[model samples]
Target: MINLKEIKNDLPAGIVVFLVAVPLCLGIAMASGAPLFSGIIAGIVGGIVVTLISGSQLGVSGPAAGLAVIVLQAIQGLGSYEVFLSAVVLAGAIQLALGFLKAGSIGYYFPTSVIKGMLSGIGVIIILKQIPHAFGYDSNYEGDVHFVQPSGGTTFSELFNAFNYITPGAILISGLSLAILIFWDQVLTKKHKVFQVIQGPLVVVVLGIVLNVVFANGFPQFALAASQLVELPVASSLNGFVQQFTLPDFSRVFTYDVLFLAGTIAIVASLETLLCLEATDKLDPYKRISPANKELVAQGVGNMVSGMIGGLPLTQVIVRSSANIQSGGRTKLSALIHGLLILCCVLLVPQVLNMIPLSSLAAILIVVGYKLAKPALFLGMYRSGWNQFLPFVVTVIAIVLTDLLTGIGIGMAVAIVNILRNNYKVSHYLYKDEKSITRDKYRMLLAEQISFLNKGNILQTLRKVPENVDLEIDLSKSAYIDPDVRELIEDFKETAVTKNINLTIKEIDRTTAPTDEKALL
Candidate 1:
């Protein structure tokens, strides 16, 4: 299934994603208060191991920003990084069990409105979070996506605070990088095949490094602080590099606290993975759907391996996945190649990676963010009617105000309310022919699926049947009828007789029909 022609595209895309992912892995590890190398290890496992087993061609997995708070607290709560690794292993096992149990179908229940809201909300968050980095205020961790900043400021407050601490060199580099990215996307890519092969982000990264070097040597006033640059852990020798990999302390794996932590990680990580998978599938240009259960299994295995080697928890990350798709990755090969590239870089040229400035990467993400939450997207959603637009806007706002899961829960709640409201009014249709007006004859057709939510509506409809009217209730097309609904219909049979209304039922199961008036009483 690995096409050679696709590799031609995947190769460059892999490198582009690799460029975007390096600092993120480091920054997330830093944010989580774990060894910096663990993030890279997780990235490597996600790219190489997960992609091999995963059914998603476009979804790239890695250390998730959303899990950073949990990871930070888990490590602190569990006493040490080694013990946390054991919990991670257990989490992976739990995910594997979930996959086998066919729990992935839970993702299908997410309405399209909520999914779009997630994507747009994340997009807005990315732009907001990256602005400070783009301006060279590295007070916050690079890959942290939460609305509340670790520095005790909100996302917008951080942006305002960043203005006072701007580094001229970072701004200049980011400005040029953004311009080049725009040029590459809008101009060079359309005009030249060579530009397509060599991505704009790559060029921006190279230019950023060169610019920073120039600033450091000749223009000290314009130079970025150490915090504004990528900080990959450097190993002087092969032994030092090998020493970076840590193994989990399986002795504590079965401890009650560790087991509890594992279950928490498993549920949160799985939910994030499923949400990201849905968003990524929507972003896929080919419109290919990834198998959610297969993805859970792949993530489980990836996390197991990552934990064995002292890596952070893994999930299908939207940022990296979106970068891969935007850069033209056509298969899982791009993810695999990116993983291998990260492994190779950390071993061979981490010094070189550390030279790339954070501003350039911020610019890349800013562009990616724009693509996800465009003004046109909001306008288009607004045109879809209030039912759709309310959930979409509510989701975006909730995500911006809270975390990913909470925002999604809010959006889903709104969507469910909309469904219930529509269902309440339209559970059944009452039709009467003009010729039957004198007789008050009515034909009632039940909805395909009727639940307790329809009970009140059905009762209202039944009560409106005028005295001496003829009524027919049809259930031929209904696949399911709630117990309450069935009971109401059966009770109505007796009421119909009292009112002198002729009642006939079609396709109603005889077992659910009243056998005697005593049964109804």
Candidate 2:
């Protein structure tokens, strides 16, 4: 049975995410050089449309920041945004194919260390990119590239520029919103159950909107222009709005550029969705497992709807999912509600939403960035072991130095190098006591397929046997014997003879192992 308590509980978080998503949807579309409404439409479709089909309870789908670079490049390369939309539709179809094939198990192939590295890298990137915006620098874009110059020199230069030319209204709203968000948590921490359940961010967003309304009388608080707000395409009637939908250019569906674009979208979007699902599952208090294949299908449907309506590509975004989980979401219903909220706002309250200060949203993202890239996160990764630590640090450094995909690739390479250096291979060993060895002295068993790295441990364990102990070494189970282990065993046997230790050797030659045995290995 569906639990109404769980649905009601998600309202606070869902509303907070809605506030957070508003400016982000607009900003991401602006950064991608797409129509501003496209991002909002994507968010709505991702939330409402995808939620119906998704197996993930907490995951919230929306336009992704990672796709901004690709979308921008596709538009430029295709010489038209409409052509890019055609590619998006084809990409959606491809994603559908991937879902039906149940290809999500591929996500499991990523080592835990690599996935942790990726999460930390994204966290660091979020913090770095949002710094300027938090300080009232909306000149460039919200999710700007790490190294790319923003018409200025560097990221720091643009940040410095914002401080020099700060807008008072933005500064006021940002400071107020940040203070409210921070202090709300502190107060809630001290309060009893009822207040604790009420999230501070939700209150801050509602207050921010209300404050804008109260101060709208000839005040600069409502001064955000169309450039800062989500700009919906104006139509004469509801029918005209429906008529504004984009259709795929089937003529070029199989063109080389379209195919490449489709592949790019499918691959990257799949990675992001899977990663978000894994992370969200880790974050789930109840430890719920999301179905990856179903998620892909849901996202495919969302993207198909988005692309057809001039919206950006969609994915299961960690940012919204984290907020959803933190806010107390227990099922997909919260996502559906949030999407309806976006649609309602777009249809009825676009004017009032236009007054929301960019700096206020920046402040919200700043807090989110802090939560993701906190000092605790670094310390936690450090404690997880060098296998995890190296990749986590490398991913963060690479992303901060380059971009997302490039950084992930470098981290994966580093992880593979570590795996190779450690000689990660499987082996099995069996010990036996033969009648001859029992009548004699010491006996030791060695298995085939043993690599050189296991030499020290295996040798040390065998060396503890007493001189009179009988030993029977069996190699029948081994399929391959490394020269190193063979030499070590030979030396040990010679030493056993001098010590009066009984040594019996048996060899088993087989081309392949038994099926059950192979599975154990």
Evaluate residue 445 in candidate 2 and report its C-alpha lDDT on the 0 to 100 scale.
47
Candidate 2 has its poorest 10 consecutive residues by lDDT at 424-433
Best by TM-score: 1
Clashing pairs in 2: 441-469, 441-470, 441-502, 442-469, 442-471, 442-502, 443-470, 443-471, 449-480, 476-508
- How do the residues 107-188 of candidate 2 rate in per-residue lDDT, one tens digit apiece? 7666666666666666666666665655556676655555566464765566667778665655666778889878766676
Q: Which stretches of candidate 1 lie over 4 Å from their true place?
A: 508-521
Please write out the lDDT profile of model 1 over residues 1-521, one tens digit for every residue. Answer: 45567987999999989998888898899989899999999999999999999999988989988889989998998888999999999999999999999999888899998999999998899999899899999888877777887667898899899999888999999999999999999999999899999999999999999998999899999987777889999999999999999999888888899999999999999999999999999999899999999999999999999999989999999989999999999998899999999999999988898888999999999999999999999999999998899999999999999878889999999999998999888899988746785687888999999999999999998898889988999998787899999999999999999999999999957676667685569
Q: What do the candidate models score in CA lDDT, each in turn?
A: 0.91, 0.73
Q: On a 0 to 100 scale, what is the lDDT of residue 303 in model 2?
A: 83
